[model samples]
Target: MTRSEQLFEEAAQYIPGGVNNPLRSFAGMGQPLRFIRRADESRVYDVDGHVYIDFVCSGGAALLGHNPPLVKKAVLEAVQNGLNYEACAEAELKLAKLIVQLVPSVQMVRMVSSVTEAVLSAVCAARSATGRKRLIRFAGCRHGGFDTAEGDPSGVSLLCGGGQDVLEAQYNDLSSVERLLEENKGQVAAVIIEPLAAHMGVIEPEPEFLQGLRRLCGQSGTILIFDETVTGFRLALGGAQEYYGVKPDMTIFGEILGAGLPAGALGGSRAIMEQLAPVGPVYQADACNGNPVAMAAGFAQLSSVLNQPLLYEKLAREGEALRAGLRELFPECTVGGVGSISSLLFTPGPVKHDRDAKRGDQGQFARYFSHMLQNGIFMMPSQFEPVFLSGAHTERDVEMFLEASAEFLA
Candidate 1:
């Protein structure tokens, strides 16, 4: 057996599912996970020393690609000082300031260790502020693994297991949300959504739909929270809020903010954010909230994106090229979404809801994913997850991917 196979066997003995995350098990592709040894700009090296062009991009965290020199240097410097102080650090303050500046709606921010924590904290704060129990989340718009946000809330009978009172609405369908709000009536604390549903294969909100949501939240006194974990730095330096021109009352950020380190954040208007402990009643705290190394790496990454605005333009161009290539390679495939965040649905056009996405050819997608991996182009194993492209991906890489995809389609 190979070294990675041996490692997987040992890992299975200790770790449940032999993977840190459920999706990393490669169950969607019907293969064992490729244990990666190292990564550099736009590429990952497996334990067997095989290199592959990375489209996962650490699940959309490595926007500037893996181990960029500046982030690496910042992390190194932070390590020399300390890993975690267990107390507030200047890096946290700096990151907060940068986030506020970039996202005008975020007047105050609180740091956390992961997007899951950030989502939970944000919802808690929303509940505290609004004094409500219900939350409305759109179908397929995954915020995180929060109990309240898990499963199909629309009573579709495809539940993934979690808590209760999470009412579901259809994407781009304002009436679905309206019905939930009407049903809950003054009992809904918040409506959390991913403006671009990357988890459900990259379906973006129509302008009318987004505006309607904002209006509905205002009418109902419910907090509007945007989970920009994947689309934050990757879509634009300002994130999906900027791209869509629709701001949320609170925003949950992750990955790109951490510069490949473990970090997440909840930010919003000062009035709402101050509701957390040390200021108000809703208590939320973490021992390693602001790990110095993570903060340093995050600061370096955000600063790089801020300084080089053209990086976003380049990413857009690459995304367009990729989309075009995919269309040429698979004429029957449905492709859409904005900026570098895009997806190819193995179905007919007009995939606006989870039901639409459910009808996709999963068997064909499995073949496509396996073929792409075998050809040294790595994408997310699940058809539900959107493929990510980084600034590190070159035209040559795009061409290579297209070539491989053409073969797979053929």
Candidate 2:
């Protein structure tokens, strides 16, 4: 057996399912999980000394690609100063300023450690500001594995917690949202969505869908929350709000903004943001809140994004090349997503919503995933996740991926 296989076997003795996250288990793929040794640029090396072109990109964190010198230098320097002072640091203001400057709707910001905390805090602030109870989240948009009142809720079931009324709507369906608004009326505190549902294998919002949500939220006095954890700093320097030209009242950012570190943030207009923490009534706190090292890495990464010209264009071009290549190679399958993110669904065509995504051939996709891995291409184990490209991925990487994909489909 391989070292990865052995390690997973041993880890299962201690860690549940032999992995920290459920998705990492590689369960039902008919193969053991690969334990990564190291990654550089667009490639990851497994413990068994096998190298593969990486499309996961540390769950969409390494936008500049794995271990960029700029972010690494900043992180090392920050560590030299200290890790977490447990008190306010200058880096906090610097990072916050950069976020506020980029995202126009985010006039104020609060840093947190994970997307889970950021989403929970944002929802709390929304509830406090609106004096309402219910939050409406779309199907297939996962904020995180939130511990709901009932324990380990999945999908729309996450809404079942704290006696807080939660509602679910369909993606790309404006009438569904409007119907919920009519039914719930003034009780809806916020409407939270992914903008681009990367969690649902990269479902982009229809222009009218987002614009309609904004209008609906405005009319209903509901706070619109954009869970940009996957799209933030990835779609653009200003994120999906700038890319799509539809802003959310509150935005939750994660991972990519931290330049491959563990980090997340909640930001919004001052009127709504003032409702969180010591500034207002809603309470949220973490011991490592605003850790200096994380802020430093974030500041460096965002600075590069803001200063670098044509970065987004390069990423988008590469992403398009990948999608186009897949469509050409596998005409039988469906391919979609936005800039720097794409997915291949084992379906004939037209995968619009969660229900549509469920119609895909899971068995075919599992076979495809195994075939790609054998060809030295590392893709998401599950069909529901996106293949993330980074600025570090070159045209050569795209070409190699296309060649491997061609071999798989052949």
Candidate 3:
């Protein structure tokens, strides 16, 4: 048996399902999960002495790709100094300053531990700022740690609770959002959405949907929150708000902001963001918030990735080429996403929302996944997940992927 198999066997005895994250297990994906030794650039090396081009890119956090020189150096130096300070650090200030300079909507930002905390904090900030209780989230939008559901690969949760304060609406349907706003007029605190819906196979927003939402929020005095967990740095240096030309009152960021580390942030115009204590009443704190290592790493990565000339252009061009190739090769399958993020849905065309994404043939996808895994391609494994591209992924890597996919089709 392979060393990875042996490791999985040993781990199953202790670690639940032999994996830390549910997607790490091969339960539904139709093959044994390959154990990775290390990742570099655009490739991951498994314990079985195999190499696969890593398109997952740490859930799209490694836009600069895994362990880039600057990030590595920053992390190493920060580790040498110390781990956590539980207080302010220079690195935090640097990263926050850089983010504010880059993201126009986020005039002020607060550090947090994970995207889940960022979402919870953002919701709380919105409620506090507007003095309302209800939150409206879009179906199929992801909210990090709160993004949990079983079986249905095309998970379509609005990423909110069923309690009195939470309400849901369908994605890309501004009419639905309008209906909710009207029905709950003066009662809704915020309307949160994944500006790009990166969770459901990188579903781009429908034309004018965001503009309408912004207008409605402005009219209702409800805060508009954009869950930029996956889109923040990956989509564009300024994120989806800049990409789509719509500014949100608050932006929720994920680990991507920490350069693939366990850190996140919530931000908005200074007036709204100051609602969080010790500036205001809404409370949010964590021991690992603004961890020095993560902060240093994020500072280094973002300073480089967001400022590098034409890096985003390269990613966008390459992503389009790859998707175009997939479209030609897998004519029956649907290709979705924008900029550097792509998704191959084993379903029909125009996959806009969760309902459309759910039509994917998981059985066919399982067989396809098995074929791709055996042939040195490590995709996100689920139809709902986005296929992330990074600066490290060479043209040859894209060619190799398209060739392998063509072989599978043949």
Each candidate's TM vs. the true structure? 0.95, 0.96, 0.96
Candidate 3 lDDT, tens digit per residue, 104-148? 998999999888788888888888888888988776776765343
lDDT of 2 by residue, 291-379 (tens): 88988998998888777789899999999999999899888877888889899888776778888887888888878788878878898
Query: Candidates' lDDT values, in order?
Result: 0.83, 0.86, 0.86
lDDT of 1 by residue, 1-410 (tens): 88888998999999997988776777768666799999999999999888999988988999889998998998988899988999988998898889999997899999999888888788888988998877777777776653332343222112222345667788899999999999879888898888888876888787688888999999989999999988887787778888888889999998777887889999999999999999989888899897788888899998988888689888898888988888777777778767787788898778888888888898889888899898999888877787788878898988898899889867
- TM-score of model 3 (CA atoms): 0.96
How many clashes (backbone N, Cα, C below 3 Å) per candidate?
0, 0, 0
Clashes of 3: 0
Cα RMSDs of all predictions? 2.6, 1.8, 2.0
| Overall local distance difference test of candidate 2 | 0.86
